[model samples]
Target: MSTYTPGESFAHRLDPRSKLAVQAGFAVAALAHTTVPGLAVLTGVCAAILLAARTHPARALADLRLLLPFLVLLPVVEGATLGPPWFSVADARAPALASYRTLLVVLVSVAYVRTTPVRESRAAVQRLVPGKPGRVLGTGVALVFRNLAVFRGDLRRAREASAARLGDERPLVDRMRLVATAGLARALGRTETLSLAMRARCLSWNPTLPPLALARVDVPVLALACTLFTWGLL
Candidate 1:
């Protein structure tokens, strides 16, 4: 849900590739270091990344609210047992750490998403990867970034419309069905519209994109990424 906003923050000025590298490195590190001490260090790193992006931790967590339930559920499901004890704390610890690691990775990613523009992200992807496959992946990334907010809005509207019709009074399953069906229909309609718009604009794989250049400032950022990657490997 965190979209790019025009800003002069450190993260905004850094090349998208650097940001992407940090995200990748952080994910690797988080996965490699799932211990309490490791997570504590990563949490501090995550906070620093958020600060660099000029994003608040609360806002980042709020944006990721949709995923929180599943994160919370994972440990619970893992801990639950069919025996008399019903639950095992030892069994839950590993999954709980894993879930926390996942959260840290996602929070780091939120910084990238918030600071990097969709086009820059696409360009970075295409640059990192070459040729037709890269173009296709870049196109997919651009479309997803651009359309996600619109799709979220469509779903919100659908839900509000359903509520206006007293749909909330219906059974939970019925309400879910109505909202889901409406959202799906709207998504299909939007997909068709997007296709037509692309055709009208003559969407091409070789379209001009904003140039990406790493500045002197990016050196430290890249170094940080490398450090994280090396730490993960160690």
Candidate 2:
């Protein structure tokens, strides 16, 4: 499960709804400020949040690795589009800001995911969103968190099994295709099992989720969210 680490930090104690509000606030706030200094503030706040939650910095950077190549490519492509000397700060600024904004968003999201369990996340969505849309979205989020670890394990096993069979001699594209196919098949099988289990349990439209309630600790988090919105307005 995507779960909370054992901790007593303020962020760890804040209500999931409050954290969700702050996360949404951060995303909206990020859009308002694209300048380097503005982005620095946003990035700093995200980092601080992660730190407050006692998450390791290395883990935070590791979470960012998947997007690093794209982040690097975007600015280069934008700058190169300007011809000759092939480096226009003016042309590159937008792409750079966009990439950094994405990084900030991911960092904050990682902090949230690490500190909240899949169960709390599902409950947060259901309570905050309401009705059919809430149920659909909550289920989707829950499934993603629940299955991500399983998919990762499947991927690792596929790589090991491929290596055992001298699959390294195959072209990169072929190797990737094989692994992808294996992973998808496993995922489908897992899904079928889960569906059957749910059906056996009388799959209801309303699956019971644990209660998420606001507490005294949420006051500060809500305040921070309000501050973020105000800053975004400015």
Candidate 3:
């Protein structure tokens, strides 16, 4: 998802720090739950977040479509693996539990990723690093995340271009050569241009923070996030 400025909502207005805590706390709660009650509580938490946030549930859920397959398969595969052996196929239960645990973790991460802007998320990380090193690292993270869509688009275009040449039926090596070369060359040229632009702007070094002032909005935003995180523990 593009990390544009989110719609103005209570969630969007939160300080980067509170938002970060909420995201982290949500993840911890996701991993801590396995029973029906645990899953219900976690699901309720996500539902409430979806309701209160600036994010459109449809779009955020669409971003999560990537997880659909695993959610479907985990229970099925696990049950299958454990069902045999004359009424007790004990083998599959472990994998099932493991898969479910992983799925919960992934779902929680998707929520965080969809809600938080890449720039804001990275800036929240800056407190630990400080100075030029922190800024550069943060900006680099933002830049990489910003490019995900462009690179994915380029991959699709490359495949389409090869298919146009009837190259899809070609030998695996030949087809891969076309796709990889096309995609990598595009990424390389873009990186070169980006490097030159950064040098021209003297952004070769770390970026400086803008002079904007933090507003009163940040206070309660942080307060509630801390409260919610503590609530999750209880």
Candidate 4:
């Protein structure tokens, strides 16, 4: 739940488009360079980006805790064998690297989300793209950003209520099903409410958005993004 926090940090001052570019470029670079040494470098870059956003690495990881199980499971499953030589470190290496790469990309994205406001992100998208399609994409981004935290909160409350009802005594599968069903129901209810609220507020495709502009400080960041993209391509 690393939603935007009001701050005067360096990243906060950056144009949303530049921040988006950095995310895109970092993702490309991460995908292109998944080796040990390359990942090490990218790790440093990721840390630097987090620092620039005034975000702690531990906090970012904590925000991503929900996905950690899958990240851990992938390599383990890939390395496991049905026969003789059992688990192969060789078989696991590539997937392990790939997972770590994914982690880096996600961390970068988290940094972006933490620093950039949902409206600014929507404005950036609408500006970059045009017509009804841009508005559609922008609306989708805004809804995802705004609702993600609410959805997480719903799931948390459902889990807590389940635990209070002695859900811990239930089978693991049953507990998961209960939580998932509760969360889904809550989410659907919220969606309907949100739709009504939007209609009441006269939600428009061309709502006035905050102005976005690249400052002198943004030049270096854009340059860094370009450099990362070029490095990835190379």
Name the 10 consecutive residues with the lowest summed lDDT in model 3.
Answer: 204-213
Q: After superposition, how far is residue 47 of candidate 3 from its true place, in Å?
A: 1.8
Local accuracy of candidate 3 as per-residue lDDT tens digits, 1-234: 434445766666656666666667766665555555776676666666655565555666576566667766765665563334433336455555556555555544555555567767676667657888887777877787788778868978999999998989999999989999999999998889888987888864444443323468767655655665676677
TM-score for all models, in order of appearance:
0.97, 0.90, 0.71, 0.97
Candidate 1 wrong stretches, greater than 4 Å = 82-84
Name the lDDT value of residue 109 in candidate 2: 86
Report each candidate's C-alpha RMSD, comma-separated, in the order given: 1.1, 2.1, 4.2, 1.1
Q: Write the per-residue lDDT of candidate 4 for residues 105-195, one digit (tens) a residue.
A: 9999999999999999999999999999999999999999999999999999999999999998999999999999999999999999999
Alpha-carbon lDDT, every model? 0.93, 0.84, 0.66, 0.95
Better of 2 and 3 by lDDT: 2
In candidate 2, which residue ranges exceed 4 Å CA deviation? 1-4, 81-83
- Measured on C-alpha atoms, candidate 1 has an lDDT of 0.93
> Alpha carbon lDDT of residue 190, candidate 1?
95
Model 2 Cα displacement at 129 (Å)?
1.7
Residue 21 C-alpha lDDT in model 2: 84
Question: Taking the tens digit of each residue's C-alpha lDDT, what string does model 1 give over 1-234?
Answer: 878888999999999999899998998898889899999999999999999999998999999988999999999999999996999999999999999999999899888999989999999999999999999999999999999989989989999999999989999999889989999999999999999999999999988999989999999999999999999999
Q: Which portions of model 3 show Cα errors greater than 4 Å?
A: 66-119, 167-181, 204-206, 211-224, 231-234
Best by lDDT: 4
